[model samples]
Target: MKILTAVCVMALLVIASAAWADAPKRVKFTWSGGEAVAELNGSPSAESLWAMLPVTVDFKDFNGVERIAYTEKELSAEGAPESCTPDAGTLALYAPWGNLSVFYKPFRESRGLVPLGRFVEGADKVSTLGEAVRIERME
Candidate 1:
C-alpha cells in the first residue's frame, strides 16, 4: 500500500510539472531592422515585466555583449536566484540600475541580475539591434 501511494504521488507530481511547462508566456520585440520572439519564465520579475509591456525604449549596446535599456518602473526581485553565465538571447533585469538586458553573447554569472525570459526565435538578430524598439505581449 505504501509503494502504491508513493507511485500515485509521483504521478501527480509529473502531471503538475507537465501542466506548468505547457503554459507559455510569449513576448515580442520589434525595432527598425530587427524583431524577436521570446517566452517569459513564470518568475515574479518576469511577471512584472509583462505588466509593463507594450513599451518602447531605445536599446543601446553594452560592453559589446548585449543590448541594454532602462524602464521607468522598477521590478520586484524577491526570491530571485543569483544569475550566472547567461546564454545568448537571454532577457534579464539589472536591479542596481533598473535596466533591462538582452544578451546577445554569453556572459559570466553575476549577482543582482535576475533572469526574465529567453528568446524562442530571432535571437540572432538581437545582437545587431539598435535604436528605438517596441516590446509587447504576443499572447
Candidate 2:
C-alpha cells in the first residue's frame, strides 16, 4: 500500500512539473548581439505594450542618462498616474512623446510618464545596447 501511495505522489509531481514547463512565458528583448528578459507589472499601459509585441526599433542614448526608442505605436496611459521618478534600469513610457524609455541612470519625475516592465537580465548593460532592438513574447 505504501509503495502504491509513493508512486501516485511521484506521478502527481511529474504532472505538475510538466504543467509549469508549458506555462506561458514572459517577454524578452533581443538585439543584434544581446538579449534581455522582462516582466510586466500588471498596469494597463504595460498590457498595451505587451499586446504590441514582436516590435523592432532603434534605440539611442537620450538625455545623457537613458536609452530611448520611438515605437510609433501609442500605448494607453489609463490607470497610470504621474508618480515618483523611476530608478535606474526602469522601463517607462514617455506619453508626451509616445516613446519608450529605458533608464540607465536616475532622473526626476515627469508628467505623462507610465511605468512599464523592467529588464530582468542585461539591465546593467542597457546603456550599451546598440541600434535595432526587437521586442517579443518569450512563448
Candidate 3:
C-alpha cells in the first residue's frame, strides 16, 4: 500500500512539472522594421505583461545595445528574480523605471530587472524598429 501511494505521488509531481514547463506564453512584437516572437516565462511580472498585451508603445534605441519602451503601467514584480544576466534576444523589464527592454547584445547581470521572455525569432530586427511598436499575444 505504501509503495503504491509513493508511486501515485511521484506521478502527480511529474504531471505538475510538465504543466509548469509549458506555461510560458508566446507573444509577438511588430513594428515598421520587422516582427519577432518572444516566449514569456511563468513569473508574476511576465503574467502582468501578458495581461496587458495588444498594446502599442513607442520604442527607442538605447545604449547602442537594446530597444527600450515604456509600458502603460508597471507590471507586477512579486516573484521576479533579484537580477539577471541578459544576452542577445533577452526581453526584460526594468522594475524601478517600469520600462520594457529588449536586448540585442549580451549584457552583464543587473539588479531590479525582471526577465519577461526571450525572442525566438528576428531578434536582430529589434535594433531597427521604428518608434511605434505593437505587442500582442500569439493565439
Candidate 4:
C-alpha cells in the first residue's frame, strides 16, 4: 500500500525529529559579568572565581553583602538552555568575582568549584550595569 508506506515514513521522521529536539545543545556559559568567564560544556578545564554547590543562589538588590538567602535542592519545571539539564543530582558552582552559577555534568564533581553555567536577572538576558555583575549563577 503506497499510502501506508508514506505514513510509516512520516511517522519515522516525526520520531527522529523529536529525539533530535530533546538532545542537549552545546553552549558557552555566560559568565562575562563575573570575575571568571567559563564555558559550560561539562568540560573539566572551565574555571570559576566565586560560586559553589549544595546551596541555593539568591540575588539581593545589588549587594555589598548579598547573603545567600535560599537553597534550591531541586529545580522542577525550570527552563534551561540546551546544555543544561535540571536533575536532582545536578551539581552547582560559581565564579569567584561574581554570583555566577554553573551546572556541571558528572565528571566535574569536587574539581575545586569550576563554573559551567550562569543565570542573569531582570529583563535583560545579558545584564551589564553598575559595579555589580548582574549575572550570577546561584547555588
- Which number leads on lDDT? 3
Better of 1 and 4 by lDDT: 1
Q: Which number leads on TM-score?
A: 3
lDDT tens digits, residue span 2-76, model 3 = 999999999999999898668768999998888999999878898899999889999888888888899887788
Give the Cα RMSD of candidate 1: 6.4
Estimate TM-scores for all models. 0.82, 0.78, 0.82, 0.27
The pairs that clash in candidate 1 are: 84-109, 85-109
Note the Cα lDDT for every prediction shown: 0.88, 0.82, 0.88, 0.33
For model 2, how does the per-residue alpha-carbon lDDT over 11-51 read when each residue is reduced to its tens digit? 99999999966553467778876887777776898889888
lDDT of 3: 0.88
Q: Of 2 and 3, which scores higher on TM-score?
A: 3
Per candidate, the number of residue pairs that clash is 2, 0, 0, 11
* lDDT of candidate 4 over 63-105, digit per residue (tens): 3211222223322212223233322222233322223333222
Where does candidate 4 stray beyond 4 Å?
Answer: 2-7, 18-22, 25-57, 60-70, 74-92, 95-111, 117-125, 128-139
Tell me the lDDT of candidate 1. 0.88
> By summed lDDT, which 10 consecutive residues of candidate 1 come out lowest?
76-85
Better of 3 and 4 by lDDT: 3
List ranges where model 3 is wrong by over 4 Å.
1-23
Q: lDDT order of candidates, best first? A: 3, 1, 2, 4
